[model samples]
Target: MRFAKQKRHRKTIKRFCACFGFREPFKVLCDGTFVHHLVANHLADTTVSNTLGAPVQLFTTRCVIEELKSLGSSHAKSFRASCRDYKLARCDHEEKESALNCIIKIIGDNNPDHFFVATQDIDLREKCRKIPGVPVLYGLRNALFLEKLSKFQDEYLKAAEDERSRMTDSEFKLLHKRLKNTHGLKDLSTAKNGSDDEDLLLQSPVNRPLRKMDTKDTVQFKRKKAKGPNPLSCKKKKSTSNSGPNVRKTDETGNDAKRSRSRKRKRTHTAKTSNDGATN
Candidate 1:
C-alpha cells in the first residue's frame, strides 16, 4: 500500500482503538460479499491483516456461509472456501436469515465485542456507521481501506468522552452504587405498604450520615481584654537606698554646714581695731 494510504488507515484504526477500547489481535467480522471480493481480486486473505498492520483474527457467522452456499455460483464455492479458514461467530439462527441481519443482530446498538466490519455491501456499511464502535473496511481494486468514523460515530464518541471527562471512575462507581441502593429502597417501599423509605431517601437528611465535629475543631478567637499600661511610656520611680534614715540625717547635716559657711563674720570691727592700734 502507498505510505499516505497506510498512514490514513493507521490513523483511523488508532481512533477506533482509542475511543472504542479495541485491543490487540483485532477481530474482524466478514460477510459473504467481502469474501467474494477477496477471492475475485485474487488477493490473499492475509492482505487484510497486513494492511491493518496488526495481528488479526478473521471471523464470519454461519449465516454468511449459508448465504454464500445459496448463491450456487462457481465463484460462490471459492467464497465459501475462503470463509472456511475463518472462525465462526455463532448467530444461533434456527432458521436461515440474511447475512446483513445476522451482522446487525451481532453488533446490536453498541458493539461490546469490538468488531471491525469487513464488507462490500453498501447497506451494511451504512448501518455499521450508525452504530458506535463499529469500524468498517472496504476494498477498491487491489487496495484495502479502513473507513473513517461516520458523523454519528463521531458524535457518539464526543458525547461519551464528555461524560467521562465530567465524571471520574470513582464517581461512576459511586453513582452506580447509589442507583442500586435507590432501586432497592424503592422495591422495599413497594413491598411494605405505606412505608416512606423512598420518600426519606429523596427528602430526608437522614439518608446521609452526619460528620461529628471534634472539640478541637471549634474555632476560638483570642479575645481583646484590658492590659497593664505600657512600661515604656511611664515615668521611672527613684530607687531608694536601704538606709533611708541615714540618708535623711546626712542631708540635714550638709544643710547646717552650708549655713555656717555662708554666715558673715565680724570682719568690719576686726579691721578697724587693727588700723587704730597701728596709728597709735
Candidate 2:
C-alpha cells in the first residue's frame, strides 16, 4: 500500500507535464472492495467529489457485481443498493477475468474513456499503474486523493518541420507526366464506320443476351415433358346423373370407357356336346 502511494505520487508529478485530464466527467471505476469500503464509510454522497479536473462519475463492472454477490447476503444487499448510484458496465470476460484483471484490461485498451481505479487494494493499484494512462484513487479520512498519470507516444509524433526543411531546390520536378497516347486522349473522334444503330442497340432481338445453357436443367425439363400423366390427378369424371330432363353432356372418352366395360361376353365354351357324348 505504501509503495503504491509513493509510486502514484511520482507518476502524478510526471502527469503535470503530460496529459491534460479534460475528460468532461472523469469516470471512476470501483471494484467489490472499493464498493464495500465506500458503503462501509457511508461515502456514496462524496464518491463523486470535485477534486479532479472534471466532475466524477462512479462505475462498476459485472465482474465486480459477481464479486460482491460472492461476499455474502448482507454485503451483497448493501452493494446492490449502492449500485443504483453507479453505472454497471458489462464485462466482456466475465468467466475468465477477475475484477482487477478485468479492470486493468478495460482501462489499458487503446483509446478508452479516461478512468481512475478507485480501490484500496495494493496489488490492483500497482497493476493499474503499469498501464500507460491510468490514475489511482484512494480514500483517506473521508476525502479522496487522485493519482493521475500521463504517458505519450514520443516516437510516433511526426517531425513535420524537419521534413519541410530537408526538401532541396534540385528536386523540384513533379511526378506522373500526362501521356498523349493514353485512352481518353487518343480517342477524340466519336464517329465510327462500322455497325448501324440497330446492331448496337442491346435491346434488339438479335442483340439479346444469351442464357447460360445447362445440360441438367434441359434434361430435367425434357424428362418432365415425356413423363406419363399421373393416374391420381383429378379427371373431370362425368357420372350419368339425371339432371331433370337435360342430361349433362358427356365427352367421347367417357363413351369409349363405357363401351369398353360393356364389351359382349364371350361364348361360354362351345358345347363340346355331341362329339364329347360319343367319345364318352
Candidate 3:
C-alpha cells in the first residue's frame, strides 16, 4: 500500500487554514520534503490553495536549499527544480545552529501574521506543532494531512486566536505607533498652511484669551456665598461658651474661700479673748 499520495486539490490544507484569519498573506515556510511534495501538488494543479485571506506564499531558506543540493538524490534534484521559482527567505543562520533552529527563530521573530510549516519530516512536524500558532502539514495514508492534533490543540488555537485579535485591533496599533514615536521615530503630520493653524487658535470672537482678573484688574463680585450653618464656627463658639462658664465658676470659688478665711480669723480672736479673761 502506498503510504502517501499528493492530490491536485487543496482540500487537505483547508482545515488548517480556516483556523486562522489573516489580512496579509499567510507565509508558508518549506524544507526539502515540502518542495518534493509541492512538485506532486503542482502536477495535480493544486499549487495554490483556496485561502480566506491573502493566498499562501511559499518561502525557503538558503540552508534548506543547500541541504537539498547536498542530498545528491534524484528526488533532491527534482525538488530543487520545483523550488527554483520561489525566493529564499533572508533568514539568520549561524554555523553553530542547525537549519531547524534557524527556521524556528524566523517563525518566532515574525509576528502579527503567523506562518505555517510544510514538511514530511517527523521531527520538524512535532517541533512546530508543539509551538503555539504554527500549523504543520505532512503526508500520510496516500494524502496530505495536517498535524495530528491532541487535547492541547484547542488550547493552543484559542491562545493564537486571542493573540491575533489583540494584535489586529486598533488599540494595539495606536499604542505601538505611540511607543515608536516616543522612542526612535518622530511624529509626522502633513504640511498645513500657517493661516489654517491661526484660524483654530482663537475659539471665541475675541482676538486674545479672556484676560485674567486680579483685585487690581476688575471689581470683585461680592455675592454672599450661599451660607450654610458653618459647623466649624459653631463648634468654636460652643467651645468658647463652655470655657467661659468654667472660668466664672473658678472666680466665684476664690471669693468664697476669702470669706471663709475672714470668718475663721474672727473665731480665732474670740478664743484668744476668752483665754486672757480666764488667766486674769
**Candidate number of the best lDDT:** 1
Please identify which of the two predictions, 1 or 2, would achieve the higher lDDT against the true structure.
1
The 10-residue segment with the lowest total lDDT in model 1: 203-212
lDDT values, one for every candidate = 0.78, 0.59, 0.56
State every prediction's TM-score relative to the real structure: 0.59, 0.46, 0.44
10 residues in a row with least lDDT, candidate 2: 171-180
Instruction: Name the candidate that leads on TM-score.
Output: 1
> Candidate 3: which stretches are off by over 4 Å?
1-21, 40-45, 48-54, 109-113, 148-150, 157-280
The Cα error of candidate 3 at residue 213, in Å, is 47
lDDT by residue (tens digit), candidate 3, 127-235: 7766655767655433555454444666777766555443333544555466555545443233233344334332332332333345786777878888789687777
Q: Enumerate residue pairs that collide in model 1.
A: none
lDDT of 1 by residue, 217-264 (tens): 878798999999998879788797656333333355455322223346
For model 1, the local distance difference test gives 0.78
Q: What shift in Å separates residue 212 of candidate 1 from its native position after superposition? A: 27
lDDT of 2 by residue, 87-158 (tens): 876566637567888888777643277676788888988776655556778777665677654233222122
Pairs clashing within candidate 2: none
Worst 10 residues of 3 by lDDT: 1-10
The better candidate by TM-score, 2 or 3, is: 2
Candidate 1, residue 93: lDDT: 60
